[model samples]
Target: PARFEEGDTLVSWLAEIVGFSPSDTRLAREVPFMQDTSTGRPAGKIDLVVARVADTGLQWYGLEIQAVYFSGRGMQSEYEALQNDVDPYPPFPGAVRRPDWRSSSAKRLMPQLQIKVPTLRRWGSKLAVAVDGPFFESMGGPSSNPSRDLNDGDIIWMVPVLLPKERGGFLLSRGHWEVLTLEESSRKLLAAETVSRNAFEQTLLEKLKPLVRPTE
Candidate 1:
C-alpha cells in the first residue's frame, strides 16, 4: 500500500505508532535484546521499543517495522535515463523489480523474533510489527487467520491504511490489524510444504551434476 524512505514518519507521530494512549509513553530504537554467548557482544536489537509506566511497574512493548526491499538492478540507470529525456513523465523501468519478501520475513525478521521473543515472552510483553497490507499478504497465507484477543496474543500485527498522495508518496492512515500467538505467526511466516526424501535427493543430484565433471 505504501513505500517509505524509513519508518521514522510513522514512528515519530504518536498516533501512527502506538495503539494505547500516548500518556507517559517513551520510545527507544535499536534496543539490544540478546548478546553473543562467545563474544559477549550484542547479537540482536529490537528495531523500536515503546515504554510506559503502569501501576505495577514500567511496561514496554517491542515494535518492528519491516520495509520492503527490492530485488533487481540498481536505480542508477533509471536516474541517468531521466536526466536527458525531454519527456515530462519518467521512463519505464530498465529492469524488472520485485519485493524481496522471503528475505525480509524469513531471514531478517524471523531471526530477530527467534532471539528476542523468548525473553519478551517470558516477561509477558507484546511485540508489535508494522508492515503494509500487501507485504504481509505475500507471506503465503499465514497472516490470514483471525486475530486473537490483544491480551491473548504475543504479537500485534499493525497494518496501516496508506492513501495515495497527489505528488508521489502516500498518506498514512488507519489500517486493519489483528493479534496472533507467536507459534501461529512463526508457522505462517515460514510456511512451506515439506518435501519427500526422494524429491530432495533428486534436487541435490541435479544440483551436483553441473559442479561435478563427467566421468569418462
Candidate 2:
C-alpha cells in the first residue's frame, strides 16, 4: 500500500483487458495533463493510459486507482503476535487499527478525480477507475451511483470482489461496475454529512473550554 503496488497491479490487469496484442497495445504511465496556467507545465498525471493502435488511429482510456489506506497503530505488533499463534490461521490485529476511509476518500482520492477526470472528459476519453469493494461501499456507491450495462459514463468504476485462491492469497475478480458523470462523482466524494446546529455548537463549546484557560 505504501509503494502503491495495488495501483501497479490494476494497471497490469487493465493493459491486459485492453484486449490487444502486446505489439498493438501501448502502456503510458504517469501521463501528464491539466497544465498550470502560470508555469505552463502539467499539474497532474493520470495513473495509467492504455492505448491501442487501431486501423484508424490510437484509442485509449485513462485509468485511476484508489486503494484503501489504514490509519492507527503499526502492523509490527500484529506480526509479532502472529508468530506465537499455534492455529493455522493466526488471529488478526493485535493492535487497534482501521481503514482510514475519510482520509483516503475525501482527502486523497477526491483531488485525483477532480484534477484528472474533467480533462479526460473534455478530450472525449473515458476515465476508468479501479477501487476495492470496501472503498466503493464506503461511498454508498450502489445507492448513489447507478449501475449500467451500457458503457455511457464519462467516469467508469470497476469494483472488484477479492476472491480467495484455493491455495492462498486472493484474486481481484470483476464484481461490480458503475457509471457516473463528473458532477455525480464529485458529490459522492464529498461524503461528509451535515451536522445539526445544536451538535455543532456543543462540539464548538467543548473545544473552546481548553482555549479559555481560566480567564482572570
The number of clashing residue pairs in each candidate reads: 0, 0
User: Model 1, stretches more than 4 Å misplaced?
Assistant: 1-19, 36-41, 78-90, 141-145, 165-169, 201-216
Candidate 2 lDDT over 83-165, as tens digits, reads 88888787866667889988888899888888777777777777888887788888876754365632456777777677788
Please, what is the whole-model Cα lDDT of each candidate in the order they appear? 0.73, 0.74
Scored by lDDT, model 2 comes in at: 0.74
Per-residue lDDT over 1-216 for candidate 1, one digit per residue giving the tens place of the 0 to 100 score: 134324544454433334545566678878987789999998878887888776878777888888777899887998899998897577888899988888888777777677667688899787888788777887653354566467767887776667878987667765666777777777767866689999999998888746577889
Error of 1 at 185 (Å): 1.2
RMSD of each: 4.0, 4.2
The best candidate by lDDT is 2
Off by over 4 Å in 2: 1-24, 34-43, 76-87, 149-151, 196-216
In model 2, how large is the Cα lDDT of residue 187?
A: 73
lDDT at 86, model 2: 89
Show the colliding residue pairs in model 1: none
Q: What is the TM-score of each candidate against the true structure?
A: 0.76, 0.74
